[model samples]
Target: MKFQIQRDRLVNGVNDVMKAVSSRTTIPILTGIKIMAHEEGVTLTGSDSDISIESFIPKEEDGKEIVNIQQAGGIVLQAKFFEGIVKKLPMDTVEIEVHSHLQTVIRSGKSEFNLNGLDVTEYPHLPQIEEDSVLKIETNLLKTIIRQTVFAVSTSETRPILTGVNWHIENGELNCVATDSHRLAMRKAPISGGNGDKSEAVIPGKSLNELNKILEDTSDELEIVITENQVLFKAKHVLFFSRLLEGNYPDTSRLVPAESKTSLTIGGKEFLQAIDRASLLAREERNNVVRLSISEEGGVEISSNTPEIGKVVEEIQRKSTDGEALNISFSAKYMMDALKVFEGAETNIQFTGAMRPFVLRTTSDDTILQLITPVRTY
Candidate 1:
């Protein structure tokens, strides 16, 4: 197999596929990237049995040629070495050729590297998914959804299901929810076109994060095909597949209170910055807890204490305050995470009581809301 591709294009393709490469795998070939050069373009694939990413560089994009394929063949090359080689290449183009006996060679500028390649036949076959169950979403919107929720997913393996983001589509609305027991993030958006059929899937947070990193064009839409155990995100020139978590995601709708006893409307940035500064002192504590006290007449105050490292107390003028006064303690890190997701000028926070989970959202928008369980400071 032999092909010449623009150095920049190949570098991007390698970077995209490398997201799925695992160095420590039972199957050695899984540690490498499978490269296939065909008549249309060159396809690069990487997988670790859980998440798989494939990037295709076509022969020509627009009026320029991105790749020229001389011979059609497939082989696997070590991802670690190939990634480094492509990035360091000092030229406008890169040439890859594989000879008999699995001898692979890479050349660019004044540098050439020869490495042994694995037979493509030994590579595990990527899942073949049907398009019967498919949903389309804007790339940027999907990225934002992942960014806003995946941070709340549990990093612990104790409850494996909590490590995934739950997605459900019904009545032309798509909702995504992620929680780690302590805090939860949920976003709801209207699907441009839908049949109103209900479908749900729990995708691993790690996979969504990786896919979000590779999605470059927000204007482009991607199709998602769901199977019994797998979900596929099909983009313009990239295909991402992730295995769905086995267990069901816990129902958390009841966790959000319909009414609140305390409410405060404050600037999102100002509130987030206050928590950010307060966390410095709270960081020394085990849970990085910060206390928020709100008064109908005195506005809101954020404070944190570290016995040995001093403490910090700051106040942000509230746009409006109502209901009962609140004295709540919560993880500073969790509050910051929720605040950063709010892009609007101000956010409204509601507290049912001192010990209840607080919900945060923009007053003008109800599509996305975040819930935070306060830490008991007794």
Candidate 2:
């Protein structure tokens, strides 16, 4: 296989596919990236069984030649070395050629390197999703949904299912939810041409995180296809596939409260900063808990205490408060994460009681909701 590609374009394509390349894998070939040169363009693929990514660099795009292919063929090269070589190449173009014995050579400018390549035939094939259950959403919006929720997925492997985010589509809305039992993050957005079909799937948080990193914040819409066991995301020349978790995501609808005993609206930025400050003191404690007290005089008090570090107290004015004055203790980390999702000027926090799960959301938007279970500061 032989091809010449623009240095910058080659570097970007390799880096994007490198996200799926695992340094250590049971199958040694999985650690290498498969490069296929065809008449149309050059394709780079990387996979680790759980996730696979394929990025295409066409010969010409927008009347610019990105790659010129000759002797179309395929080769698998060590991802670690290939990525480093491509990035440091001191030239405007890179030339790659593979021999019959799987010997690969890369040349650019005055630098040239030779490495042993593997037969692309040995690499595992990516799952071919044929079922047409697909949905489309803006790339930026999808990234926002993943960013707001993926952080809440469980880090432990005890219940493998909880390590993934639950995605449900119904009534032309896409709901992404993630929880680690103690806290939950949920984001909802409307899907174009979406019908009220009830479809549920669980995708690994790690996969979504990788996808978010590669997805550009563009106005272009991304096509999402869901099959029985795999979810595919296609945007322009890139294709991302991830295996779906096989267990049912726990029903979280019941966890959100229908009413609140206390409700307060506060500046989102100020509230987050208060929690950030309090967390420093609370870090020495077992739960890193911070206490929030809604005052009858229309302000909220934020405080935290540690036996060894002493305590901290601050107050922020509120938009309004109703129902009852309440004091609740919860993890400051959870509060900060929930606050990151709110883009509005102020956030509405609804507390059912001192011990119940409270909800935080923007005052003007109901599409996004975050729930945090208060830590029992007994």
Mark the 10 consecutive residues where model 1 has the least summed lDDT.
189-198
Residue range 1-378, candidate 2, lDDT tens digits: 899999999988998899999987899999999999999999999999999999999999999999998889999999999999999999999999997689999999889999999999898889988845678999988988898899999999998999999998888888889999999899889896534468889999999999999999898999998877999999898999999999889999999999988888888988888889998889644668899988776578999988777999998777788888888999988898889888545899999999999999898888889999998888
TM-score of candidate 2 on Cα atoms, chains taken together: 0.97
**Candidate 1 lDDT, tens digit per residue, 94-176?**
99999989999999988999989999999999998877756778888888888889999999999999999999888778899
Supply the TM-score for candidate 1.
0.97
Candidates' TM-scores? 0.97, 0.97
Off by over 4 Å in 1: 192-195, 296-298
For candidate 2, which ten residues in a row score worst on lDDT? 191-200
